[model samples]
Target chain A: MEDNQKKYTELANRIYDLDGAVYECVGSSLGRTFTGGRERTVRTLSMLMYTKPDGHLLRSELALISNMARTIKNKEEKSRMMTEYNEILMEIEKLPDVFGKVDILDDERVRLNLAAKREKLSENDHLVICISRTQGSAGNDIGFELADNLKINYYDVEIFDQVMKRLEADKDAVNDAENFVDFNKYTKKSGGSLKTRFREFNRYHGLPKQDAVFFNMSDLICNLAKTEDCIIMGRCADMILKNNHIPHISLFISAPFSVRVEHIMAVRNMNLKQAVRFLKKMDRQHRKYYQFYTGEKWGKPENYDLCINSANYGIKETIDVIRRMIGK
Target chain B: MEDNQKKYTELANRIYDLDGAVYECVGSSLGRTFTGGRERTVRTLSMLMYTKPDGHLLRSELALISNMARTIKNKEEKSRMMTEYNEILMEIEKLPDVFGKVDILDDERVRLNLAAKREKLSENDHLVICISRTQGSAGNDIGFELADNLKINYYDVEIFDQVMKRLEADKDAVNDAENFVDFNKYTKKSGGSLKTRFREFNRYHGLPKQDAVFFNMSDLICNLAKTEDCIIMGRCADMILKNNHIPHISLFISAPFSVRVEHIMAVRNMNLKQAVRFLKKMDRQHRKYYQFYTGEKWGKPENYDLCINSANYGIKETIDVIRRMIGK
Candidate 1:
């Protein structure tokens, strides 16, 4: 265990150094826009390192970091660093699972806390708005302002932290849920044919670890929607609530690809090329993430109730349009 | 020549018969939505037959008609029709081009008409708005209203007629223009590098017959923009004006796929499934057409100055937003 901990610590520290070096090299030349790439990877890896240190995530991160490192001008040094990271990855694959089985249902404390919170909430007549948006479409800004106008709690990254906490406390919960299929419950809720219900069950069972996080995150979103009138941004919340038969106004905010690239360039002080690359990468990630869990095309108009082009109306008018939509 | 005329007339009549029968069968059952399908195909084929009996277009139309006919309930009848069409297609492939070459440059009448029209117009400080929209987004309605409010000429299908008239008068004009590659003229106009200019020249040279029609349509749009203020709908007019350095505001109108589907169902009296299928088909066609002509992604925000989700703000509010955008 001590040896594993040392190996993990050394790998984490190296990732930190490489991240800083890449940032210092590229960020200085390209301004601040390039910081999000390697820097974000390191940040995410660090969070995982501190929490779970899942082998699959670490391997993927190492691969990404090595790819980014190859872009550096010093080819010889980067190649050497990549070789070292590959060796570390191989070693990580051999390491035994550090986390033991967690009995989620037997945890009285978590259940009690959830029950107490549920008891205090009104749980009825609560308005929920799920806004899915493209990168740099000012979706977050619109969501925040809309939340303010309606005097409601806005959940964005906060929901991620909540899900993460739950996951840390009950690592086996998701695995158990995947193993346990409630066909009757699903069929009753979906009103789908037995074949479709079976397909849905298989989809739930086959979810990857990362996508399972989305599953848990979706549960948290459903809970939050029930507790209060709040605005949820991204995370396939719209589909989640709809599947749960919750009444909510779902909005998809997008702008032209060029408009989004320009918006990112302006906000992040990125050059045009950098902005375009960043937006493309982020858009692909968002699309894949949304599609993996929902089994629907991302940004397709039919999925959402209202689709708004933020560039058409800007921030203020966009909010006004939504306000009018919900009659708030 | 008389033999070719008889063959073309016979083929056209067969297409009309097949189209009517298909419509009479499908339209009666599916309501009005499916009427636009094979019926529109027949109408386009009839127009082409009357104006320019281009063998390439005739072959494609036969292929389309035969494919549509295959969908008919009477498989044996449809297969017989398909076999007959295939034989006609073979005959079309062998027919010599009957149309005489037209001298586009020495046409004094056309030049004089265009010159007279140009003279009648203000020719300066006119607002030209080009709108590109997805199907069922009420883009045509918005363009008409915007034109009405601004009191500008709205050109939609009218532009197609104008282009067709010019093409019929001078069949060789497009071919001549494609062959006459003035490198200096292109370089000076584009201010692109020699390599890019050579590539652009190749793109122009390699345009298919159908896309070459777009090239002529673009020329007409440019001429109209210079002569007077007008709102041009579709036909990649936005890129056309931008290429000519003609100042114009381009807008792309779209709605959520579901919203647009519902709109079509309501207006066309189509069922839910039929509306969804129609919108998807139209969207794919528009995207392909736009990309072929302009080499730009259709309905991309950056391509247009504004992209309005008309569902957010119905027809009236959408027009009002555009009015505000242009400060009209």
Candidate 2:
């Protein structure tokens, strides 16, 4: 019994170590900072291992660890590990569950449910254009020109201002959202108890401020769609509008990596490497944000009515093409 | 010494097993067939282990093995293997070389050298357009119309016919290329000595018929560019022309995955799932072929002067956008 306890503890320690490595790898790959949530999750799983926690929860956590292992750079070792991993899974499956059940906490479900409850507008009743673009793709320039060409209101940063105004009624929420952004940007190492760290991680990952901002922004977008014909840039407006069954033409503007890199270099006065790095970071952020909010793949053509490589048609012609697309 | 030999053999066997797994994974992932060259490579490395082979050669071979390991789906296993993999690298680096030096064989080098030797037409001396596209993106229709609008010769499968005619002079080469394609399409298993198997793998992976066809098609593309303004579709004409330093406008056409699937469904009468699968296979083939030949990422904006989601502008507007970009 003592030997078995030691063996399980060793397994838990290995899981903890692997989870950290994966968290760091995924964070660096996405150009984001690693936070405390993953570690907390790992600790929870580690503790629950003794009690024979829910198999599904255990499998899901282990699956994440496995994903990181696949990134291993050596073949012979990888295969050996894979074989061992298969054995571990078999062992896990055989372990009888005797403890209290642990339910998976999915905050995204709440957001999705809220989205599903939105009042959908008739297809032709609203004219909204949502432009999602990669950085330096001239998406903003094109979106502005498109709105001008069609004589419609254009919402970009103004949407943020509107959301902030709405959040002003709850000053603490606004302050928390602002602080969260600041924390994400500047906080490298966080200090707290494991429980507090886990809560902080959940607050950032699952949302409190970010979620509040997103939900409020979503409401503003739907309201605008009902009130007037307009063009909304970023903010996952395309998805928010879609959630409401509002008639909107979604456009994804992208240019080749090199072209966009060049554009960034020219506009931002950054060198090639810096521009590339900046673009990758921005692209990742947009993708993550979109995926997080909408549960849809961003920049995928089926999601959008029209997708354009804006570099193919210069800014003016890109606008012209959109105008023609809308038959204006 | 006997123990060392046994240990090396064990390492070799592990490499062989892992290499087979990787080859199968990559082939299935790309929807291609696994050829024999990889096994031969593994055997050579195994044999060389006793003699102390070139560190670079051994490393490169191991690198391929390592790449396969990255595909392992289990995280704990992946991490464990990766750690062991790093240790193996340290061990390999510590080994003393004591045998004849082996040089890496790269057939792509010869192709690249041949490309370098081609005569470059001055910019503005040639007005050539190359269009590369995803399956079911209406790239062909756009290319045909763009050619008609420009009053230029449009080459599509005609390039294949022309290449076939060129290869006819070398009937055996033509027969080999044709037979190779048939073999790739139909042959499930091959039985041969390791040497012959390796050679067959090299022939397919590196080139003989496919390479010959590619080179001839390249020559034709360059020659045509030098003589007249024309639009070339597929056939890596863009890269071929670029390699020759011939002036040309390259365009990549794409539509959203769902949109393309619908297009294929309507055009080919395939159901949604079938169309999706078909599109994915075709896209993978084109990507593999393009990468194999050009050594550049396919559908990257930097490679092409313009890329359009044809679904955005439709056939006519898409053509118009291209025509306007060229100041037609």
Candidate 3:
């Protein structure tokens, strides 16, 4: 990371004005901003275009800035940093520029054919989207809305219910106060069933039972990957779909504490104290669920293909940005 | 949480249009705004007043808006929320007329307070900060120039060094990589020195080495804190100084993956790959250390007094906002 920073800082120092350029980069991102500025002005413009609604930046942009902002002395090293930064952008603009070095993908089963993935892409191309979010992070609003906008089969939690029904039919999975525990604990005699094992795992982790009423929101989100294109929320699908890269886009949405509190307060009309209680509870539960399932902390930013401040760039714009990224 | 939300929503609906005749009941919260405008316009204006940044309202015009904003059915609840939003601010704000019974602290703790800790403030203040970032998130840059305007001290850290030193001072007391075989192992050791136990706990979780340097950076930061106010990049000082809630305001700065990546690329001059790598590596270390010490997800908005989107707010304003938040 330090080495990375050195590269960026050196580049940052070279650019006298950042306000113009940053905006131009952003303009390119959204398309058709008022242009007619030199590179110097465009450079500084980027600094002025200084906001993302939910906080977090795109991976490609991060590379450019990190290299640009680095602290460096040796001109050779500085040039090398610039080269590396450029290579990354050019690679992301289409891929194959990086050759076949697949990074950020951990799944051993994934077959990499970057070109194939690219060729298959279309405005209507299907995708497996994993949205891992904080509890009460308004992920449902974004996820469901995204599916609605995409005009594909939308599934917030209904998908999990369907899966659970199939999984439980084989076994006498009953729902009770300890529904999750019982379901997770028991299965058919022949290794029970996947649902039973999952139920047992859920029981182990104290997850809600996979009843018609008790759903696995996370699993529902991940199953979208197996299907064609779908938007799933808060289930670490990015990591799950790691092997099948390309069409996969991950997003982490968050907002400032005050803004979130205000939204909760206004929407729910909860007094401040109650709002705090609810927000904390949801955040904690989501964190636990994330940790339990992924063995990794949620909202860590690094875990996702994208981390968006739902409050900043917002849900609709975020979707638009992703659409643009996929060049759809 | 839902229940609380329902209650708040119900009350907010009622207060949505308080009549001008009910001025006495509403108190000074809606003074002039209620006097002349149509009730609908007044309500819309009231909502806008709260939502928009206080610039077009103007300094002189703010008095009326402030009055209208202050009008509330539940002063106690509002005060409590206000404190939570800006603990230091409530400590010093002109308490609302119905501040009593709100559990608002009169005898507030007087430890080191930050300029950023102040509430309802928007003045520019110079700040020095330290940061502990995740591997794939460009969190270090916020710390990079946070001290650009500060007069006193600054220490930026990728790894927490002070805690490492504490671990090193007592190697037997601390676990040194070899002790644990599983990733889930965590210390719940009690009846020992808090410092020693924390080290033992971090060891089981595969946290960075005790002498990784972030902990020492924290020590240096805290030492800096002992004298003047600074924006701490990271280090579980909020947890470490749990008792001393006043003076120092701990801020967890983050952005979504894509945003941060973009930020790293532009700011650090890194290629996409290196930026992603840098963000992930540094962020993971920080999260591990943070969760290990704090027993809370590091970047949860609630854990920190202020959680800002460096991408949303931009680095300079984030620093400015922090300065204002801490009331530096």
lDDT of 2 by residue, B1-328 (tens): 7866666666665555555655454442421112346556446655666553232234434543443455556766555544555565555444444211211112232222211112443444656788888878778767765765664666665334434554466434443223322333223542446787567557655664556656766776788788867777787887787678666667778776766776676655578999888888778767777787888877765455455666554666667656655556
Clashing pairs in 2: A65-B75, A66-B74, A66-B75, A69-B78, A120-A244, A256-B301
lDDT of 3 by residue, B197-217 (tens): 577568645444443333444
TM-score of 2: 0.49
Residue A114's lDDT in candidate 3: 16
DockQ per candidate: 0.02, 0.03, 0.02
Where's the lowest-lDDT run of ten residues in candidate 1 chain B? Answer: B98-107
Among all windows of 10 consecutive residues in model 1 chain A, the one with the lowest summed lDDT is A98-107
Cα RMSD to native, each candidate?
Answer: 30.0, 33.4, 19.6
**What TM-score do all the candidates reach, one by one?**
0.42, 0.49, 0.35
The TM-score between candidate 1 and the true structure equals 0.42
lDDT of 1 by residue, A103-164 (tens): 11112211222211222334464777888888777787677657656756666653344334
Tell me how far the alpha carbon of residue B167 in candidate 3 is from the true structure, in angstroms, after superposition: 42
